[model samples]
Target: MDNVRIFELAKKLNITSQKLISLLEEMGISVRSHMSSLDSKVAEEICRKVKPKAQEKATIPRSQEKAQSRTSEVTLAETGRKKPVQVSPGISLKEFADLIKKPPSTLIKILLGYGEMLAINAPLSEEMLALLAEELGLEVEVKTVEESLLEEGEGGTPELLESRPPVVTVMGHVDHGKTTLLDAIRHTDVVKTEAGGITQHIGAYQISYRDRKITFIDTPGHEAFTSMRARGAMVTDIAVIVVAADDGVKPQTVEAINHARAANVPMLVAINKIDLPNANPEKVRKELSELGLVPEEWGGETIFVEISAKNKTNLDDLLEMILLVADMQELKANPHTRGNGVVIESRLDKGRGPVATVLIKKGTLKTGDIIVAGDVHGRARALFNDRGKRVKQATPSQPVAVVGLSAVPSAGEEFLVVDEEKTAHQITAERIARQRARIAGPVRRLTLDDL
Candidate 1:
């Protein structure tokens, strides 16, 4: 008799491959992949374990099944006591089920009863998990930490550790002079690039302030895209909130503040348009205080600076504050290892085919390196710094526009440095195949008879 793979057996049993894999692992089968071949005798044993013989199935009574479920539920309600299972934030339902010593399928059925149809890998908030645990007669404890979906970069030796530039994100309401401030700093007219003076795209730029480099990420307002603004806050080391002195705080300004706070980054308040006659710096300060931003001048923690992009007043002070904050944070990264970072933006160019703006969080990205961003993989044929200068290498905390990806990756996707081109292609192919399999996985379709 020929051998069969685990997935084939799962299909025959009308179950998912993932469930089969988990079962095999629990059984100490030493299986690595669902494609791993099983011995003929072992496959038969597995089939018997998953499903009983036809005679047994016919003999089992429906009343017995209901009684068994009721008994299990009653046992769970009476057995457990005060032990709380510790779980990370946004833990998947399957993982939570395992933590609670229950089968994932049981939890899935419970969720279905609650009208929440979720994937096996879908995450549940702590509150939701607590409710589920309560029903299961279990207790759960949540662990909090600064979270990042990006993969950890390669480690570095002491000699390779160096201070990197600070990645700053500018966010605020519309007409807050965000792009204009960046234009003044970079000494270029990027405000003209946007239609109607509203920045439509995320722009990363680098500038030298008093001999030190700072990379600025100019994020679009929520009117353009809320996701873009959220991405900006997540990736940045510092957030410079540009509140118009004349306008104080607007609706979008509060949105920006919330985004920054959620990212848990240090914030600096920039009182822009201070040169205007109607500009009230004191009124802006009072409004920010109400929002929990007590200025340093007022004996609070936040650092605030008054500036005018048009008149070029106190621009240096803002830059100095950014550098000071970066120094206090003590940002350092490894330059000798492979690069890993988030994709700030991606677009197709008529001339260049596909291009992406990548901000390196750790390690160094060089030309000719194989990179994988999401399911897309390609060689780094070229790299240009934020200033559009063609560069041979990019270090940590630097934003570079890359050319030669197989496809334009989605904004905010984390890219990893792969060892070889063939390996990169293989990994990307596996990822794509997994995505396709998930899409084609078993789903309960709606039927007219059910309706």
Candidate 2:
């Protein structure tokens, strides 16, 4: 009995290993860690004093408990009233036990009865545990992750919103000339600059047309670059899908449509190579209309333009249509606040250390500003525009290459500009810790029969 581990004793008392360690130390017990063995007499004494207190703590309303502690149930004795247990989506088994005021061992027994074995801290979806809670005579109210984010975003006032440039993503099939269309608009040979004539990275650039500016994100059109295309759609205000006039719609074309639709961004189809002798703009329109992109000329909402990238015809009309749809959407973001944006791409450079292409979604990003992106943090050492010119700051809807990240962040990761280096480092540390916990923690119990 002297070989009893401290964690096993904590389990029996329904408390965390850390809490049990503190209690043992208060009793003059010299345990060094959760894995330390405790004498039978000392373990019994500790359990006798800790079990009732743990039960009482478990019944306390989560609102009044320590924020560091797991959320638990509302007690009838404490308030002379009953309240439905608050459960977040994907609640863990240990949290479920606390919310229902049941011992983890009891929950394990119930799971075994249903032919399922799960780790005590394994997460379970609300849908999988709803019936179980009802059978146990406990009411559960679930709150989803999306609802929380929406609530936070809705708290912003209308006064902070200002008109911003439309961010457009060019997407289509490989060799469908998405880059060539952008090249024709910018009056630069981008396709010729890429290695092997294939764009391997996401590029962000701003183009001025008719005294108005539009930010264009050129995403790789290959099927293997699906993730890059999805990220492009996420940060953009609109999608410009280039379809070869003679080739009609293809597999990657369908995927681009789906990505734009999922991001809820309006799409304008660009029928390229219309100058070719075999070009068929009408056929391309009809095929895309079948995929829910009915052309406005056909009495539908979608705007379609036929252009020749090589000949650069109707390119101005394409730019005008992009502004028309952007004006209708009334896209805006405040430029006076702290900077926030999404990482377009990142890599380690021999001369630059860590460099990233970031698209500024809101406010202004400047040199010396401490930036944090996912698990990375650093002060902006330098900012360069798309044209390779050094810039002091970038405003909303502008993309700049920033050089000074501690590590290259994943594409599509949201970055925020904090006031102090300490805050940036703290945020990076906290996020890194959370990610590690999620990876090292118990495996999620996905179903009733999961073992």
Candidate 3:
């Protein structure tokens, strides 16, 4: 058959052109007007959906009946879980359900359970992709990081995109063993009582495990994590929420889960305090599953690791899960380009002047690079790693303390490297001006008498 016009299809289906167009739009099939054309495939799909009565009344050949029944029975459910399904963001629910070989009705029902009144024709967001898959007991892989690599070219080709360490954020309640867990991983005493050690200071540290690296952002809680997101920086790849097995899930724990979900970062749960006699890992799993973070052991995708930070038990297992998730994400960056990153933290030091801890998301940051962060522009006079050791250069996913910003930058500010100091100044100046304009509002004109 030939490509069908919107009006023709609408007439054939006994529906108005506008209604048919709305349906097409819901499917994300960009037909604009009554005269818009639909390809043969789309026309067939429309006919199948709108003319269901005709299809039901139509007779099928005896030879093809068995084949049709077999095709209907064969789906992802029958095939069993093979490999994770790779999905691109912004696909319609119908498209996604078809990709997973599941019925669109199932997806719609799942969405309704989550209070999302979306239809099968609605386009699913990236977060929805992960959520719907989890509920259906399927795995979905969204091509976000690699698509970003291609977009953030930074004057380099795809060849420059290489594997980078995953930036993992740990968030939870105050007394749920977050500090102790971090201390165990880094082998350093985190001052739980002082903000200078963890709360006030937003820092990121990397640990080498089994010849691979994992970077952890030590933020106070979900607040700091979301603050960075609000600044338009997606610095975190995976979020590991620390939950106490003995205490079960607390109010703050729920907040952390919601924050992680809102950020749309993949989550792994660390069931801490398992060393306690009263610890109940199963209870913790049940509570988290109710919050939509079902553990893999329970037939869901979320990884749950029961550990005791005090004894440093099962720490390797948690780190291994993090690496496994990171590997699946396929994190990469173009380290050869100019530095691009976000400010993890910044403060004015009496001796060193304005010091900013920046996590380089892509490219190599050097000591002599002219950089602009938010509204501040300066030369990177020096660079120091998480260990306070002086470093000449930093690569992708490497967090470094930079010296030479004229003013302390806010955490989560976008940090960039430019060709010259003047360009940096120009960019920062423009940003500052724009901020001022927003604050000042539109200029008020004089009244008619004054004019």
Candidate 4:
């Protein structure tokens, strides 16, 4: 019969049409009639060829091989010696089930019996797989680097890598030299370089120290460092909180601290404007203690460093402290893998189209790499560092401004370089469709009185 009729028959038999067709193709069946005109003899021959042989089923014992052969079979009831599964990147429940020839629902039920309480569609962890394998008498082994790396050139690396960069967000009250501190760290005149000498938009910068890299997100205070803090929390590995020694802890400074605390990132305090005559580091430290940022000297976890952006005092100390925290936390990456990075900020450039400041967390970002940032996808045409120098490639922990995006992606969007434009376009289309669905729904409006 024709493919459509073959599919109809396969569905009637409660099997996947594709599977049935594949079986028929393998058996050399070439029926091409419509559903209504198919000859009974031809149909019978097709069914006989596609159906599993009775002798094949008889070869293995029912208890041992039944579940292994049947796609619909599941081991719901737990065995006594169940091991927990640890979830890793790119693996899904359906794929796991397919590997074991069991239904996803059956696997999910087995996980729930072991206290996982996961849905059929929920992502499966290695721990979950281990548990399932233990109960089902399957061997569990850790994936090797060679096998994982084999997928790199083949474009099969998972979107979320096992390891990620530590997100460092810069926060402080208005005009507390937060931007200046970031500019000083990156050696960029971002504060004075901006159109109005004020960072009206959120900016992302990546700084390299002794072969290590740390990302710094510069957020605006006039608008409630909310967007900045949110981005920081989403990807942050740590927080560099700027507090003016002359001004002590102001309202927004307190807010920034709260954001860092809420995100649970380790904090390092920068007591800025140390060059000022009225600057008081001791008083600032005491005030910060009241706000719950007890410095390390005071037996708390936070580290406070006194600095002056104008005179660049104690800048080396600040960098060293950041590196110390990162090292203590074991900040590392496999630089030989495919490139993955985070969007520090995205904006429409007047002459360059959509420009994005992306921190290269791992691998190398080169010109003409097809990239997708959130819903926006495009190839990188040009890359520039904070110094405005054009570069061909950026390695781990380096930040670069890239041009030639299809559109301005949102700030804090994660980006990945893919192999082909078709794949990028497909992913971008799916993301845009999801975004539309999210925004198309009725939105709850908050009135001014709600405040």
Candidate 5:
């Protein structure tokens, strides 16, 4: 057997490197650090000793478990406090401890036991604050800052969250009718407007179905747009896999499925060109079923709809299934909070300094708001909808083209509105500095662990 480093061995054995090192020192093994290596015989002997101790750690005594049950079983609601203390997110550890009237060291100890090693000044997420509060037998409310919400004209985290429209992505092989399907859904000839029927830039749009809305991302079928397609998958709540009935399943069709699955989003199949005499919907379904996407009609969970985008047939069924799946997810957002979302696509135009197509995931983005997108920040000079009409504001699940970014942000980067332009500038400056440092940093050599 080959020798292994202390840390790697500890990881394989499901124990901490420090604990293993301590055990080695107790056994007079004299391992220097977590990086120190041991021969096979010494490693086997160490494992023999460590396994029994690991079992002891794994099997807690009934007394301690019973004691833990009484505290762990009690949730915040069970505390029954008339007025709960509200904790704002992203507060520093020291600040949080001060607010809770607990010592910073005590909170640090709790976090350490919970497998976190944070500095006293390190920012704490709302979840961390809640965990600390629970450990102290206290009930605390976690929410976005009320002042920021009020400034943006949004109530702080609404008590009853409003349902947001589901963001859907249409993906498939090139010339397999993805564009035609989108045109049928939008009832607009977008390809006709573009030069040579090829879009200069594709982003996203919205369409109403049965009084409800669905956001559709215009992802082209070029290999160059694979990253953009992956980004679309990440933000999309549902992915519509458009497979040509005549062509069945192609390599790109499988690639699209991989991207959606990688993002862990739900998928629906659109069997396009079904009106063609050569169309084989069954063959398409069989190929897809082999890839783990069996249709619901065939006793699988994946939804499938045969549609002729040219004739605009069965499009209603597709939208209905999207809404049905979205309802099952209970998709919602707190529109009462400051607006924030992901950039769909961005570019610097000759006429317009910098413009970005963004999909709003939560809250509302309004005109004149100071927005920060990655390393760039600016005030929203204008907002345009999918139809190119100027809009005063965009609500949750709405995709709109935005104007007035300091620089074109990369697609998939998150954008959020700040209360002040000064804050936006400060944030962008910090992010820019960090990015530069990363770029300027020396190249790191690969390690065995990296493999």
Candidate 6:
């Protein structure tokens, strides 16, 4: 009976083939054989043992019929299509609003009028999910019996609710110990630890200070940072501007400040080289003030900490200050929801293939999560922390390296996890189309004098 064909079981049980498939999926079983080849004995056994429960029709409730009807009308009116909305499981309302170009408040009102009490931060219900899918021109269908069976066979802990860490980018001039400072914070000589003493590209690392985790993006201090800023990708969350105490603010320091301002991320001034003989903290603060980064002690919005990355002085204070700023911003995202993170950097690793260092903003990412990275999509097979240690899953405020992408996603691209591979590919295609549209649009002309 268990091995009977799905169609035969559906016929013997007097149920729709689709409904039978749904039931099998719910029971975590798979149906393989066709109806014509189904063994009569097995089909009879399945028919005798399984029967649909007497229940109400699978129709919208009377109270919600008007809302559902309106939703269907709106979807058709907008897209000129009568297809049902396909709501991917585990996506958040804010994400949905961004996807459909509607304000979250408007979406919430629409959902509330339909008897859904979901908050902006709350997870979507199945009925509400259906409504959203309809509005977005997607198909809704129940899981197949085979899929349910597969899910059961892959027993693993579902993602937990956790806050993702912020992606921190360090910007300063050459010889500012930007790499050395990161090595000191992470307690590894990554600079010298590399094959060569030079870091050729952007490297991402995750460091834990007490229980809190922070992801650091080591961006090239040369012209690349400026180039990245011009693109408006601005992949960094917090900018740690390293200013040598003795050297004070150099020309590159000023450029770093402008880059941080252009990206619109908060800045923290770290007065490095304080342990040196010629290091002067007061002089550096005065110089920084001229660049508009007034220290908090001097009634400025920016927080300045004096430290020596070489001797590891006041490193604890630096970490604590970063966390303090993060708290003030209320940097949080629901990890139990689908993955929503930013790509700090991407590269091809010889051993791991295509790898992306992502700073999870909201939602949790685990092994096997199908992710859409810009124009690329793939299922994550391995995750590595900033220290290059393998981890099962990364939560909010975590920086992790993900492998198994179809291609190298662009740096600063936003990542989202989809419910299936097909949906992931669809999203990637849409993003590519949008990018093409942007490039094909008119280009604005600016005079050299503007510089």
Q: Write the per-residue lDDT of candidate 1 for residues 1-451, one digit (tens) a residue.
A: 4799665676677655666777888888887544467899887877888863231112223345446557766786688645467676667988787777788888888878888887889999766786788778766777531112122233323444667899898989998999999999988889988999998889888888878899998887633234544445245889999999999999989998887887788999999999899999999999999999998667677888999998889999899778767765767776555688888889999999789999888777899988988688888999998778999988888899999999998887778787777657656675676679889998889999999
Candidate of highest lDDT? 3
TM-scores of all predicted structures: 0.63, 0.64, 0.64, 0.59, 0.64, 0.60
Cα lDDT, all candidates: 0.78, 0.78, 0.80, 0.70, 0.78, 0.71
Specify the poorest-scoring 10-residue window by lDDT in model 1: 145-154
Local lDDT at 86 for model 6: 37
Which residue pairs collide in model 3, if any? none
Q: How close is candidate 1 to the true structure, as a TM-score?
A: 0.63
Off by over 4 Å in 2: 1-157, 222-233, 444-451
Which scores higher on lDDT, 1 or 4?
Answer: 1
For model 2, residues 289-388, the per-residue Cα lDDT tens digits are 8999998767677889889988999998888778767765667776656788888888899999999999897778999988987789899999999888
Question: Of models 5 and 6, which has the larger lDDT?
Answer: 5
- Report the backbone clash tally of model 6: 17
Count of clashing residue pairs in every prediction: 0, 0, 0, 14, 0, 17
Q: What's the C-alpha lDDT at position 173 in model 3?
A: 78
The predictions' CA RMSDs to the true structure, in order, are 25.6, 26.3, 24.9, 26.7, 20.1, 23.7
Error of 4 at 281 (Å): 2.3
Candidate 6 — which residues are off by over 4 angstroms? 1-166, 194-198, 222-235, 442-451
TM-score between model 3 and native: 0.64
